[model samples]
Target chain A: MIKTKIWVIVISLILTVSAALSVIIFTLPKKNVVAIYSDGELLREIDLSEVAEPYTFKVEHGDGFNEILVERGRIRVSFADCPDRCCVNYGWYYGGASPVVCIPHKLVIKAVNSQKDDFDVVTG
Target chain B: MKTKRIALDAVLTALALSVFIIEQQIPLPIPVPGVKLGLSNVVTLFALFAVSPLDALLILSLRIGIGNVFAGSVTGLIFSAAGGLLCYVTELILYKFLTDRQIWVCGVFGAIAHGVGQIFAAVGVSATAEIFIYLPVLILCGIVTGALTGSLAQVSVIKLKKVFPFLPFRRKKEEKQN
Candidate 1:
C-alpha cells in the first residue's frame, strides 16, 4: 500500500521534472560560441559567429588529443585518439542543453553564448 | 554453499555484462548524455532479490568492472562505477521496506541515485557546476528507465523462484510466506 503510493508519487515527480528538462534542453537558442574543456580546464572558446575562416586545431590533453575542426558557425571534434571516439561522433554543435562530452579523454565541448560562458568562473 | 553462491553470481554477472554491451549497440533514440534505457539494471534487480543484497552488490561490481573493459574506456569505467555503486547501494537499502510487488519503487529511487552520482562525478571532473544543468534530465530518464527495469526484475524474481524452489533466496521467501 505504502509502496504503491511511493511509486505513484515518485513516477509523477520524475515525469514533471523530465518534461521541464526536455523543454529547457530542446528550446535553448543557437549559441554563438563553444568552449572546449579538458580535465576540468577550459582549453579554448571559439566564437562561431566570428569565424571568418574554417580551421582545425589539435586540443592536446594528458591522455591524448581531439582534433577540433571548426567552421563559420559550428564546431565538432572531427578526430580524436580516444578509444571510443564518441565525441567525434557528436558530429556538430547546433544548440542543445547537452554538450559533446568526450568520455575517454575527459573533454567536454559545450555550446554557449559569448555574453555568458559556463567556464568563466572556473579559474577565478 | 560458497560454490553455489559463486556459480550463481558468475552467471548473473555474465547476464548483466551481455545486457550492458548489447544495449550499447542499440543506438539511443535520444541524444541526451547520461541517459540510456539502463536495461542491464534488470539483472541487478533480479539478483538483489534472487540472492542477497551482498551478492547483488558483488555481481553489480563485477559487471561494471568487466563491462567497462568491454567498453574500452578508462574514464567510462569511473562514471559507470559511480552510477552502479549508487544504484546498488540505494536499492539494497530500499529493499528492506519494499514488498516483492513494489520492486519498481527500488528501481525509481535507485535510478535517481545513479544519475545523481554520475552528475557529481561529471561536475567534479569537468570542474563546472554548470554541468548540473544535466541533473534534471538524467533523473527524469532514470525514473522511467528504472521503473521499466524494476518491473522486469519483479516479474523475473517471481518466475525464477518458482523454477528454482531449491534456491536459498526462494527458501527465505517461502519461510516468510508460511
Candidate 2:
C-alpha cells in the first residue's frame, strides 16, 4: 500500500505549483485592446484606452442578453439575463490573463495585446 | 438485505442533496465561476469508502441531477455533470490503491480532475480556449477544498461505523486487528 507521507508530499507539490502559477496569472500585465466573442465569433473589439466616453450596449444571444458597459479603461457586464449572473458578478475586466465569461450564452470578453487586422483569421 | 441497501442509498442521496443545496446558499468571496467549497462532496467521499462505489455513484448522480434542477442553471448542468463524473471516476480508481487512512488523497486528485473536466466543458460550450485562463486558479482551489472535505469524510467513516455497525462499512486496520 502507498504510504500516507507520499500522498501528502505529492499533494503539497501540486498545491505549491498551482499557487505559484495562480500568482503569475493574476499579476500578468493588463492589456488595453479587448475583444468580445459570442458563439466563438468575434462580435466586437474595443481599445479601452481610447474610449472618450462610457457607454452601455446589449449583446443578445438567443433568448438571453448581456448588457456590456465599456468605460475609459475597463469593461464589465453591467447586467445579463442568464440565471447565474457570474459574468455580471465578475465586476470589471481591466485586461488580465482571465477573460470575462458568460458560459450560458457562449460569450467571452478577453484582452488582447495586439490588434488583429482580420477578425476571421483570429477566430479561425 | 436488498431493501436495507436501497433505503440506505435513498437516505444518503437525500443527505447529499441537502448539503449540495445548502452549499449553494453560502456565497463565495471569489466571484469566478466554479469556485466553491464543494462541501457536498463529503457525502460522496464517505459513501465511496464506507458504503460502496456503486452506492456512491448513484448518490452523486442523483444529487447532481436533482440539485442542479433545484438550485442551478440549465447550462450549469453541463459543467456539473462533467466535473462530477470525472471526480467520481478518479476517486473510484484511487479507492483500490488507497487504504482507509488515505481517502484524502483521493479527494485531492479527484478534485483536480473535476477542475480539469469543468475547464474542458467550459471551453467546449464557450468555444473559446481563452476560458482556460481559469485553470490554475481552479486547480489551486480544488486542492484546498478537497483536503477539507476528504478529512471530514475520513472522520465520518471512522466514527459512523460504530454508530451504525449494521451497515457494511469497512473497518480500519487497527479496528480490524482489535
On lDDT, the leading prediction is 2
The residue-level lDDT of candidate 2 at A112 comes to 77
Clashing pairs in 2: none
Per-prediction DockQ comes to 0.25, 0.38
Residue ranges of candidate 2 with Cα displaced over 4 Å:
A30-124, B170-178
lDDT of 1 by residue, A12-40 (tens): 97789777986897786444778888888
Summarize candidate 1's per-residue lDDT along B1-178 as a digit string, tens digits.
7787788888888999999999888876765667878888898888887788888888888888999998999778888988889988899888876777778878888888898888888877778686777787888888888889899998988788888877666333432320
Instruction: List the global CA lDDT of all models.
Output: 0.80, 0.85
Docking class of 2: acceptable
Model 2 per-residue lDDT tens digits across residues B108-158: 888888888899999999797877888989999999989988888888887
